[model samples]
Target: MPADPESGQGPAAADPAQQQQQQQQQQQQQQHADGRPAADKPIKRYRRTELEEEEAKKKLLLLEEEGDEQYEEYVPRKKRREADEAVLMRLQGLAGPAAPEGDDDTGSEIDDEDEEQQQQQPASKAARPASVPQQRGKESLLVQTARAKKEAPPESATDKVLAEEADMMRHITQKQALRAAKELATDTVYTRSMSTGWKPPAEARGWSARKAQALREQFHISVAGDNVPPPLPSFALMKLPPPIASLLQQKGIKRPTPIQIQGIPAALAGRDIIGISFTGSGKTLVYSLPLICIAVQDEMMMPLEGGEGPLGLIVCPSRELANQTVEVITQYTDALKAGGFPELRVMLCIGGIDMRAQMDMLKRGVHIVVATPGRLKDLLTKRRMNLDICRYLALDEADRMVDLGFEEEMREILSFFKSQRQTLMFSATMPAKIKTFAESALVDPIEVNVGRAGAANLDVIQEVEYVKEEDKLAYLLDCLQKTAPPVLVFAENKRDVDAIHEALLLQGVDVVAVHGDRDQLERLEAIRDFKGGKADVLVASDVASKGLDFPGVQHVINYDMPEEIENYVHRIGRTGRSGKTGIATTFINSRQCSESILLDLKHLLKEAKQRVPQFLTALHDPLEEMEALAALSGIKGCAYCGGLGHRIADCPKLRSESKAQERSKKDYFGSGGFGGEM
Candidate 1:
């Protein structure tokens, strides 16, 4: 026989006609019944090989096994049963009333039947379309339950109790809020009404404005604000208590200084005041007398209980000043007690002292507290003391405090006061910035200025000398001989203070030194010895320049001119105290002192009617004409730093502070700092 073509064997399989016929038959079988040609159907372009298909089937089986294992591990039969029961109970609760007992039994029987059917089926049955309707029915039930819960009434006793408790807590919170608001409003109203309630004395009421102006002019006093009280003539005219008046007489203070003359009456009238006067002009007594009187009155009304007081707070800038203020107040307190008034206690709070001792004093109930800002803030922050009953607040050397970086602390302390209180700020020099600060901190304050603010004391004789740097030590002896014992020497730095102290000691002169580096006890001892007349000379840095009252100092020598004119004013003020005249000798070095400061010094000397040195007069200043114009316009000196040679924009202190702030920011933010890539 010939080659069999149907078997696709031998040479017949290679024939094109035979293959075409077979293809035609296969196409006919694949054609649609509507007579559409097979060519219209999509052709499969790629097909998996046998090995690829086998690998896919194996992957499918392995995935099925893994899914079964995970489902069994994640949801055991017992856990699934428990979860189903919990969900059913929740749905029933949301659906409203509980299900009947027979219905619960029927539901459990149905669940058991379904579980039995699932166990009899293969694992692949989980993916069958038969379960989709069951899942949809469960979702519809959940929706119905949520709708029912929204319409249901809250009738359970537990929910009613919780609602009542919530309402009670809300009511209590609202009550507390209202009480706090009422107290705040009362404080505000009282503070605002004080100015209207204040009145002048009978003698002061009758005086004409022209007469008052004449008195102020006669004493070189400057007053600002409305309803100012007239200046009393003497301590006796002040209407002080008999004990205080007698005490003043005993201390030989029959007459009040210009500051005391005006400040006392205003304070007695319960007016807040910003008292500006030269150093050694009885600024301390201005506040002290009022504080003592107020404290005494409080004590008489009701004796302080343990941890109950300080009725009055005096904030000083330095430890030495705080100690001195305590002494001054103690003297008046002792007099009050001797006169049969209630006993009052004064305590000192400062750094470098035992905090335990201060705490002990507080426990005993101190009526008056004289403190530095740092220590006082520490006590207040730690809750060791409180200002709840403190009604009188006085800031001595406020400008100095602000300069020493205590402005923030002062504001924080003010926040501790629970109610309106009397606030008084006294300083030798009140810069424009400090004046602005006082305006915000004090309420309707009266500004009592003894003279042009930052002006030198006229009672002191200022003598300026030019000395070569090398010959200063030898010429220091000549300046010392110009005055007697109890002289103060001020230097700009600690090293200079030590050098001068040693030189004086080697010369067999009784001298003591004080600087910031010295221990507190040593510094206090030095000051004590100088005040006691055991030391003829005291060499110190600018630490001694502010608010330190060294009585009977015949002379003050500036071993080095300070960088700022404010320091100079305070240094010279150490002398010329208590209506007594003294001498202030300053040595100027052309190389060490800046021309700006020298120009300021020259202007100050001219303003005080003192003789200006020839060198200072001959020195040419570019800002001289501008300064004159400013003075004519009633604007004098740098308002920021009290320098006559520059304005606030050009203030050195402000520039330095700004630079320091920027440096700190850079340090905190890393080398690239803020606004740069890390």
Candidate 2:
């Protein structure tokens, strides 16, 4: 009773008195509630060995279910509602405002009224009302979402800066004005000369051998001379003195052109050269370099006397050519002086200026004289100029000089020079007569022919039209409307030149006319205006064909076919110069196509690889047949009397025989005899 083994009981709870009281209370409670005293719960216990066996059994049956299941219920993935989904989508679409009848699947909502308006009207017409302030915005927004959208407008050319620049350009002075004009001219030449896609050589030394070879092949350069000099690899290889070479470099002449390549060396070596190249083939430099080199040498060797004549003489065919040559030589000589070389004096003795001034300049001692044949011959006759001491002679446009009937003057000028002087002849062509003249003029000359003799510039695209003489003005107007300035128009005579000039003026075209009839000042002014871009077109005769270098000429129009085939080559060469491409349009009448002209033109086109017109190709010149007939008949008809061997115009036998006949007649019919009366 002191303590129970498994129960936490104090000695007081085990007391006898307390037990007796508890039994009494329990008996009472039993009687009151008909309940017996609460019985003690029995304790259940297991051996430690049984507990271990139970844990072992549980471990052995580990796969047996433990408590509640944790995995999701097995249900097949919900089958796709194939047919029902379509109905659902349709229902969803129907739930929204019903789409218009012709509406596409685009999820846009359109007003019923706007839809009706769009359906009732054409598509191009806007559906919005004019009175609505937001009409354009609404339609543009709609169009932004539509299948087709209108293209945006192009940007305007007028900008704030452009307006200001234009205003500023209008206030420039004459010199500044010329500068602006020449800038455009230079820009045109630069743009055309260098292709947009071409890049400079990487090394910058000069054109590589591969590049130079490509140029030779492209330009079809043919070189034939004693020890035919290889094209100068660069200006450095020219073997020129540093001053001269640097001067050329400063002038923007980095390398030799095809003509200059072969021609310069031949002339420099003291060989008489017959340099044949197309116009603008850098022919000026062919003789110019030699002239300068010799001048420098002559000056360095001995100081000039006050009355000494020019050391070098260059004769051109026209005053314009002589002037142009003088200007170019002056530029180069100025460059030479800038490069530390002795000052070389160059003067122009061309006509249309003061002869007395030219005489005065000559007396003061000039190094080089560029003159036309007429003026030079006049000076020579008056003893104002001398070529007796001249060691260098050049005849620029030699063929043209001869063609212009300057043979006597040329012979006279050549005779005045020492027979031992070196000579150089540059011509666009070398015809039989020029060849004969060259034989007498030049000794042991090296021939440098670039391409074919008298060939058109390949850079010029030639087009021939069978136009009537009277309709040329109308046709030219049409062409001008399509082409850009500056245009050069060639006519056969001064009358036609003036007529075309007047017609162009009437049509409100800026134009100038130059011909033989124009005074020197007037002609110079016309050329100046044309070059300055003040005149869009220059109407001219054959006088503009040779030696004048007009910059940035984009087109050449031949309103009249040249009477001579050689002149044709020169006429078209006006446009395409210095590597710039141009177009040449020739107006020809079928009736005027002579056999010689037709043959020459066709051959030229074929050689240049240009397209030949159908009319020109189809034409059969009858003169060829006549020439064949004449050859077979051995007629060799004369130009004057239709006789053989001798032209009646220059036949001494005919003249003498006529004189003898006249004398006999007078003798026979003396004093009004019967023969005279009959």
Cα deviation of 415 in candidate 2 (Å)? 2.2
* Candidate 1 lDDT, 1-678, residue by residue in tens: 688757877655777898899998787867766566767876533222333445656766787877744422233343355466456545555322232355222333333445654763464234333422222224587899998899998656434533553453344233211012334446544444133233456777899989988998888898888878888878766776688899988888878889998998888777889999999999998888877877776677788999988888999998888988888888888898899988888999999878998899899999999999999999999999998988888999988887788877877787788877788899988877667766666767899998878989999999999999999999899989987888999999999999999999999999999998999889999999999989999999988888999878989999889988899999999999998999999999999988878988988998899999899999886566454446443557565667776655456666776666665564456667683335
Listed in order, each prediction's TM-score against the native is 0.70, 0.60
Supply every candidate's count of residue pairs whose N, Cα or C atoms clash at under 3 angstroms.
0, 0
Residue-by-residue lDDT tens digits, candidate 2, 462-558: 9988898688889999888657899999998888899899999998999999998779988888888998989999999988889788868988999
What TM-score does model 1 achieve against the real structure? 0.70
Residue 575 lDDT in candidate 2 = 73
Error of model 1, residue 474, in angstroms: 1.2
**Which parts of model 2 are misplaced by more than 4 Å?**
1-231, 241-244, 621-678
Cα lDDT, model 1, residue 636? 72
Off by over 4 Å in 1: 1-201, 631-633, 675-678
Model 1's number of clashes is 0
Best by lDDT: 1
Candidates' C-alpha lDDT: 0.79, 0.68
In model 1, state the lDDT of residue 310: 88
